[model samples]
Target: LAPQPKAPPSPPAPQALELPPNASPVLSSGPSPPPAPKASQPPPSGPSPPTAPKAAPPPPPPSKSGGPLPPPPALPGSSKTRPPPLMKSGNKTDTDEDSSEAKTKLKPFFWDKVATNANKSMVWDHLKAGSFQLSEDAIETLFGCNADKKSGDAKKDIASKEAAQVVRILDPKKAQNLAISLKALSVSAEEVSCAVKEGNELPSDLIQTLIRWVPSTDEELRLRLYTGELSQLGPAEQFLKAIFDIPYIYERLDALLFMAGLPEETSNVKQSFATLEMACEELKNSRLFLKLLEAVLKTGNRMNVGTFRGGAQAFKLDTLLKLSDVKGTDGKITLLHFVVQEMIHSEGVRSARAAKEQTGSVSSVDNNDLIEEEYKQLGLQAVSSLGDELQNVRNAAILDADQLAMSVASVVHRLGKTKEFLNTSMKSLDEDSGFHRKLVHFVEQSQTDVTFLLEEEKKIRSLVKSTVDYFHGRTGKDEGLRLFVVVRDFLAMLDKVCNEVKEASKVTPKKTKTEFPHTQVFSRSPA
Candidate 1:
C-alpha cells in the first residue's frame, strides 16, 4: 500500500472575543503555499521552477450566460479594496517574463475584481494554515496593480498568486480596499481590552494600552471604548456589573440610549448593533435612572421628580407630581424626558451647589486668565466650562439630554394621537364579541398609562428649586414661597385634567375606532 502524506495539524481555537453573528467563518494561520524555490542567475534556456497550484476559479455566472441581470447592491461591509502589492526591486527575471509574454497577460484588474468579490473566510483560512508567501504575492499583484499592466513597469508578476498578499496588509485604508474585493470584510483594531485578568498571545504592551483605554474619563473616548469593552464582556449579568461601577457621563449616556433602542453613533455603521448591546448593559448600571423607573412601574407615577441632580436638599419645594404622556406600559421615553428636563433645570441647582460647596473655604480666585484658559479648553464663554461642565461634560451630557428628550417627546406625542382615536367608549360585551371587550380593556389600560406619562412629563420640574438663587448666600423666603405658589397652582390644573379624563372615559359610551391622529404616536406602541 502507498504511504499517505500526513495532514497538517488543525488550526488553533478561536480566541474568546464575542464575534458578531455574521462574523467571518474563515480561521487564519493555516499552511501557506511556500514561495517558489530559486536557482540563482539561471540562463535564458534553463528550465523554470514548478509553481504552486492556484486557487479554484469561480464558477461562471448563470445570469451572465442567460441574459442581463441587475448588479448586486454594494456590500454592507466597507468598500475599501486592498491596494496592490509593491513590485519587489530585486526580481529582474520577473520583469523579463512579463515583457516577453505581453500577449497572454491576465489583466491585473481581473485579480482586483476577484479580491473584492471572493469570500473573506476562504482567504483567511488559507493564509492562516501555512507559509502563505506565494498566495500573498498573487493577491498583492491583483489588488494593488491595474488592468493596463503593460503601460506600467509592474515587473510582470505572474497572475496566479495575487490573493494571499491582499489578505495581510493591516492598515485600514489598504485593508479596507482589500476588503472591498472580498465577499465581506471588517476592519477592527485588535484591542486587548479587559477590566480584570489577562490573556495569552497578545503582547503585554498591547494589553496595557487596552487597560488604560477601557476606563477613559473622556466622554468621546469612553463612548468609543464602551463598544470594544462591552464585546469583551460576553453575554452575562456580571459583565454589565463591571461597566456600571465606573463613572463617566458619556458612558452613562451611551448606556441609557442603547437600552432605550435609539443607540448613539460612535464607530462605523456596521457595528451599530454592537452599540445597542453595550447600551443595554449601561442602562443596567444607572442606579439613579433605575430607581426612579421602579417608582414609575409601581404607582404609574408620571409626575415623580425622577432622580435629583444634586440630591433632595437641592429642591426648595416639598412635593413631586404625577402625569402621563403616552399609551404604553413602560414609561421609558416619558421618564427620559423628565430626566432631561430635570438635568436642564438642575444645572442652576448644581451651579448653586458648586458655589455653596466652596462657600466657607477660601481659595485664590485672582488667576482669571488661568481660569479663562481652562474654560477655553472646555469650549465655553466667560465662566470656566469647567464650572458649567461639572454640567457640559464637554457638551456630551447636554447633547444627550437634547437627543433623549427629543426621542421621548416624539414617542409621547404619538401616544397622544392614539388617545384621540379611541375617544368614544366601547359597547357592552354582550352586544359586541368577547374579543371586542378585550380590545377595549387593552386600549383603556394603554390610555391610562399614556395619560400618566403626559402628566408625569408635564410635572417633572414641579418640585425642583435652586438651593441658592441669589443669596446672603440666602435668598428671601417670600421669594421662595412666591415660586412655590406658582408651582402649586400648575399642579392643581394638571390634577384637574387627569381627573376630568378619567371621569369622561368612565361614564362615556363606546365610540367607533378611528385612525390614530398623530400617525406615529404608536412608535413604541405597547411592548
Candidate 2:
C-alpha cells in the first residue's frame, strides 16, 4: 500500500484532563472521558479520519470577584441534585432557588411545622380569635395540654376552650362516681314533681345528693339546650336533663331541701320549747332545790349581819357557787362545807320527824345512835339525787338562744325564697300545671305551719323570759339560759360539797355530828 502508508504513529496519548484544585466531581454532562485508545491494531487502510478537536470544558461559573468559583457543597446522602450555589452580594446573600427547593421538599411534612412552639402559638391564637370548629379529640388535647398552665385571662381562656364541660372528661373517675351516685338516687322527674306538689318528703340523702350534682351555669345551659334522646347521654347528664324538664329546676331543688329538712327542723323547734318549759318548771317547783336556796340565803344573811346586805329577802342563785370560795375561820372548812353540814342535819331531822309521824309514835330516846345513823344516810341520799331532779335545767343550760332563733329564721328565709321562686320562675307555667299548682299549695301549707311554729317559738321565749324574772327578780339582757347555767354550776358545787361532807362523816363521825347544828330545820319552801 503506498509505501504502506507506514503505520500511522499511534495517536499521542490523550493529555490527562486537569481540574480546579477545589472542584467536585464534574457533572455527567460536563465532559466524556477521551475514548479509550483503540486496541493496538495494524494501521488502517485509509488515513484515519481527521481527529475532531476536544470541546473546551465549559467555563466555570463566575464569582463576584471574577475568580474561579469554589466547588458546590456535596449533596446530602445520595441525592443527585445539588442546591444552587450561594451568591454573595454586599452584605446580603441570595439563595432564592435554594430556599424554593427546600420549601418544595418540606411540603410533604407540612404537619411537622406545628411541632415548633412558634407555630403552636399561632394555632392557639387562631383557635381563640376565629370560630374554628374542633373535634372532641382536639378539644381534649387542647385542654389537657394547658390544664396546668395558669393564664392571666383565665375566664377568657376557659370560655375559648369550653373548659367548663372538660372537667368530667379530664377526671373520668369523678365522672364515673357522679354517674353512679345519680343512678343510685333513681329519682324520676315525675316523682320529684309529685313529691313537691303533694308535700311528700323525699329522702334527705337524695336531696343532698342532688344538691351536690347541681349543674354549673355552662353545664345547665348545655342541658337546657340539649333536646336529643336521653338514652344517648351519660347517667348524670340524663338525670340533669330530665330534671331540667321541670320548670325552675333549681328553685324546685331548693324547695326539696327545705321540704326534706322540714320535719326535723320543726321537731327541733318543738323540742326546744319542751326543754325550756321543763327547765322553768324544774326551777320553780322542786321543793328540795328551794330548801337548798333557803339554806344558802340564811347562811349569806348571817354572814352579812352588820352590812346593808343583811337579811335580804332573797339572794341570786349565782351567790351559791361563791359560798365555797369563802373560807371559814378554820381555813380547812369552807362556808360551803358549813352550809352542806347544816343542810344534812336539817334533812336528817326532817326524815326522822317524817318517820315518827308515819309510825304514829315518837322515839323515847331522842339521841339514839340508830336514828342519827338513819338521818345521815337519808340526808346524803336526798342531797346527791338533786342532779336527777334538775335534769331538764342541765339540758336547758346548753341551749343557744341565738341558734334556736336562727333555726326558725332559716325556715322562714327558705320559705320566702320558695315563694319568690313561685312568683318569678313558676309564673310562666300554666295555672293548671300539676307542678305549679302542687308547689303553690305546698308553699301555702308550709307558710301556715311555719306561722304556727313562729307563734310557738314566741310563746316559749316569753315563758323563758318570765321564768328568768321569777327567779332573778329582773330579766337582764342576757339569755334566759344564763340562769340555768348558774343553777347548773351551783348544783355541781353542791354535789362536790356533799361528797366532802360524807367523806368527813366516814372519817370522823362524832366530829361531823357535832359540827352539824340541829337547830335549823329545812322546810320544803324558801323563807
Candidate 3:
C-alpha cells in the first residue's frame, strides 16, 4: 500500500528531447545533458565533437607576474655539472659530456708527439722534477743490471752505460743512416710492447738496444707506460723507472748527451759550410783561367780567318782534337809543334830585349841571330811557363763537373736537414735559455749562408755553361764530352810536343851539304 502511494506521486517518466534543426544543442535549454555515458560505454556514433590532444600538463603556473617559474632547487649533494651517463651506440639520451668522452676515446694516435728527437728533451725536463721507483725486472731489462748485484751502486753503472748508448743513438752523425736508426728504434719499441702484452719479459739485449736508442728519459718512459698511451711499448714505464731511480742522475746524463750531440752536429755543419765556401772561392777566383779561355778563342779565330766556319764567335772545345790532324811536310810534326815553336820564339824576343836593357849595351851581334840563339835556349823554358799558365785552366776544365755539382747539392741538402734539426730540437728549450738563443742564431746565420751559396752556385753554373759555349765546343751532340775531354786531350798533345822539342834541343844540328859553283849557278839559271 505504501509503494502504491509513492508510485502515484512519481514524476512523469523522463523522455529524450529532440533539438530543432536550427537550434544549437548548447542554446536549447534541455534536460541537463544526459548523464555522461559510463566510462565502459562506447561514445555515440553520430559526429562527435572534435577533441584536442591532451596538452602537456600546463607548465607549472608561473610563480611571479609575467615571468616563468625559476628552475627547481638542486637536491643536496647533486652537482651542477653532472657526470655524463654511459651510453650505447645510437642512444638518443646521450649528453654532450658523453659524446665528448666517446670522441676522445676514439682519437687516433699521433706518432709525431713522441717520434721526434726533440721530444726527448722535454722528457728529460719531466724526469728532473722528481724521483720514481722502478721494478727489479725493469732495471735488468733496460739497464742490463745484474740481478745478483744487491749492493755497491751497480745499478748506477748500468744506467750510465745505457745513457751512453742513448747518446750514440740520438746523434745522427754517429749512425751510418739516421733514418734507419730511428726506424729501428720504432720497431724495437713495438716489439717491447708486444712482449710485455704477452706476459713475457723482453729480451735483455733488445731492451738494452731500445734504451740505447730511445732519447726519452726513464722517468718519461715510466709516465707514458702508466698512461698506456704507449701501450704497445710494453713495460716501458717500468724500465724507465728502474734506470732513473737515482736523483739527478738522468738530469746529468741528459745534459751530457745534449752536449755530446751538439759538438758533432756543430762540427758537421761547420765542415759542410767550409767545403761549400771553399768550392765557391775556387770558382770566384778563377779569373786567370777564364782569361786563358779567351786567349785560346783569339788564337783559334786568327788561324781560321777568311775560311768557312772561320772567325767563329765560339769554338767547340772538340776542335782541339783536330789541331793534331794538320802536320808539316815532316810527318812527325803537327800543328801543336808549330804552336809551341811560336810560343818559344815570342819568349826569346822578350828575353833578348830584357837582356839588352839590363846590360845597357848594344852588342854588334845581329838582333835576329841573337833571337835565334835565345829561342833555342828558351824552348824548354817557354814550354814550362806555358804549362804553368795552363795548369789552372786544366784544373778547372778537367774536374768532373757533374760530381762537383752533386757535392754542392749534397752539402745544401745536409745543411737544410741540420737547420730543421736545430729548429725542432731547440723548441723544447726555453726561449730565453742560452742554448735556445744560440741555436736560433746559428740557424739564422746558416740560412744566410745557404742563400749565398745557392746564389754562387747559380753563378758558377752559368759561368761553366758560357765557358763551354764560348769555346766553340761541340754543339748538340757529344756536348758534355766536348767541354772537358777536348781541352784535356789538347793539353796532353801540347805536353807531348814540349817533350819532343826538349829532345830535339838536346841533339846537335846536322851540317848542310854545299853545292859546287857550276852546279849551283846552273840550277839558279833554269827556274
Q: By TM-score, who's the top model here?
A: 2
TM-score quality measure for candidate 3: 0.39
Winner on lDDT between 2 and 3 is: 2
lDDT of 3 by residue, 294-322 (tens): 44556666667798856666555566577
Report the number of backbone clashes for model 3. Answer: 11
Candidate order (lDDT): 2, 3, 1
Top candidate when judged by lDDT against the true structure:
2
Candidate 2 segments whose C-alpha is farther than 4 A from its true place: 1-201, 226-238, 308-311, 329-331, 362-370, 420-424, 431-441, 502-512, 515-527
lDDT comparing candidate 3 with the true structure: 0.47
User: Who is ahead in TM-score, 1 or 2?
Assistant: 2
Q: Give the alpha carbon lDDT tens digit for every residue of 1-527 in model 1.
A: 99756544444433333334554544324333332222233223323333322222222233424443333333224486655555669856457667746533443443434344354456544556556445645654565434455434453453323432222213334334333422122212322122111111233333233233333234334433454334332222122224344333222222222223322221222132233233333333443333333333332333334744322222332222433344235544343333322222223233433454579645532222223223222221211122221221112211232343455565456445433433432231133433234334544655564455445434331212231242112453423223333333433433444344345445865332231111221121111
Residue 301 C-alpha lDDT in model 3? 65
Question: Clashing residue pairs, candidate 2?
Answer: none
TM-score of 1: 0.16
C-alpha positional error of residue 404 in candidate 1 after TM-score superposition, expressed in Å:
5.6
lDDT of each: 0.33, 0.70, 0.47
